[model samples]
Target: MSRRTASRALIAVALSVSLAACGSDDGADSPDSSPSAAATEVTTDLSEKPEVPASDDPAPDELVIDDVVVGDGAEAVTGSTADVKYVGAFYESGEEFDSSWSGGADETIPVPLGAGRVIPGFEQGIEGMKVGGRRMITIPSDLGYGPEGSPPVIPGDATLVFVMDLVEVTP
Candidate 1:
């Protein structure tokens, strides 16, 4: 498998483990369920390559979702899979850590939306995205990797930023 695929798998496993440990299968208690005022204050621009602003710490609560491009195509919904190109970075430094784009245009990944297979913020972020749409998602630690973090690359209690382009949706 490619690095991007591996990363996605790892994220899925991590999220699954976390959720199982908590004995919650529905993700109802997730922080991303309700958007806070701070979550709506995020700004995003997708005209060119995305640039995330640096922050020292994660948002106290809530996940931020900002739309960059609204595509005129089929919307991605729960239980559906979305083919996407994405770049991930640390919110504190805006330093890129992973990107499907790095592997070229053909590297788009198919990810399940709202299946608890990914981080809560990511699952919620793509809820209304259409094929060809683009978005920037800011995830607080609680809604991301949480206090344990993803190890060497992602720090404990760190915030994450992801810029995603929804290429297609398969229901």
Candidate 2:
């Protein structure tokens, strides 16, 4: 084919592709597209309870964890990854809500230090700990579970105490 004819054919093909893309109704699989109006509902089994303002102090009757000793190490950034074994509890009644050691699990998970993956307090407190170290972070409700607290086991406005074991450094 002549150069002008070949160029025209290529241009026509490009225009066709553009038009087809613009006409597509499927937004789910499109990279730049948003979820369609028929988007599925987002739900979870565990629901958080509304929190109340808690005392700034760790409750007087809170149970004591003898083994954990708080420390200071690296200032953890949002995306920083750390090797940590953690046990969480309500700061009020001192109930064990969730833990990495639950069901006698010994393996430590690599926690991505960020906002969503972890409680805001745990994420903020664990920063600045060196490897082979531990920190007993006592987070007040505002810094912890917040207004929408993890309920039943973790009561609203409950202070949280975490014994964070920093096993290694992945950064």
Candidate 3:
């Protein structure tokens, strides 16, 4: 499939998974409180337009998840849909590939958490977030586009970084 087609397919899968998961709110109330402490320890800035990190290259096996702004609202569970604004960039070149912020305020996307619709690292990175939270996720190539990559925009074996603002969670 073409890159754009694959992306659309992924989004469709995510939406379907979100709808199915939302039908049964089994674990919505049992929010894990451990991440709250970690959120307090993080001091990263979460600008609407975030600056790219200056690192040359991160380890290919690493999946770094840092909370930029911790929210006091509901915790993001595994089978939930999160309304978010995000910017994705290549870790090596610091070039942005996609962004919800670029399309203005109404462009926030609903991402299915813990589903296999998105990259593996992205799914894991968003796990413990709360509504109104901001997070910075640095994903290795293995967990991102992998060996084949997205092409044109994303190079093969490229690591990716995302600055995400979780606006709300629908369980």
Candidate 4:
């Protein structure tokens, strides 16, 4: 079967598993798949942010990238073109849920970075990163699940986290 098909099937299974918590919301199940290595690995054209002055804390909520660790998260932002791979874990249990490229292969997926293709946290988080930079992004429940989470591993209103390594950028 095609990888995409397999992924869809996995999403369906994941939803069922999550049903234990989010309740059978019936038709609210989103076709959104868990983060793939590629999703986080968006090795996009790197445009390094100018050093924020030590006192430079824009919106206290805006997240900043430092050595791949996200801090002071700003509202989510989108990249222009990204090639990446990623690994996802549930915030509550810290259990790995998905990855774009398993075994850390040098695989890159080029995508038009935006909201629909990826989760809101992701589409908004990796903005202003350089092409070959690696960063870890922690997404809040609101940007992640809102209120009802996909059950089982991801509890209701669960937050999600991703350890991403922006491997390359297609420019």
lDDT of 2: 0.54
- In the range 40-154, model 1's lDDT, one tens digit per residue, is 3334343345555566554547777766666679988888999887888887677898888778755788889867888888888787778777777888899999999988888
Clashing residue pairs, backbone N/CA/C < 3 A, model 3: none
- Which candidate number maximizes lDDT? 1
lDDT of 4 at 86: 62
Model 3 Cα lDDT, one tens digit per residue, 55-104: 55445577777666777787777889888878787776657889887888
* Candidate lDDT values, in order: 0.74, 0.54, 0.73, 0.51
Best by the TM-score measure = 3
Evaluation by lDDT, superior candidate among 2 and 4: 2
> Which tens-of-lDDT digit does each residue in 1-171 have in candidate 2?
999999999999999999987765634322222321111111111121112122245353322222233234563455778877766655544456667765343557777877467666666655555664454556677777666777656667666776567766665
Question: How high is the lDDT of residue 160 in model 1?
Answer: 87
**If ranked by lDDT, best first, what sequence of candidates would result?**
1, 3, 2, 4
Clash numbers, per candidate: 0, 6, 0, 27
lDDT of prediction 4: 0.51
Error of 2 at 154 (Å): 1.7
Instruction: Summarize candidate 4's per-residue lDDT along 31-126 as a digit string, tens digits.
Output: 122333323443333332211111212222322233443223222225456665666675445467776655445655554567357667765555
Extract clashing residue pairs from model 2: 70-136, 73-128, 73-129, 74-128, 74-129, 91-159
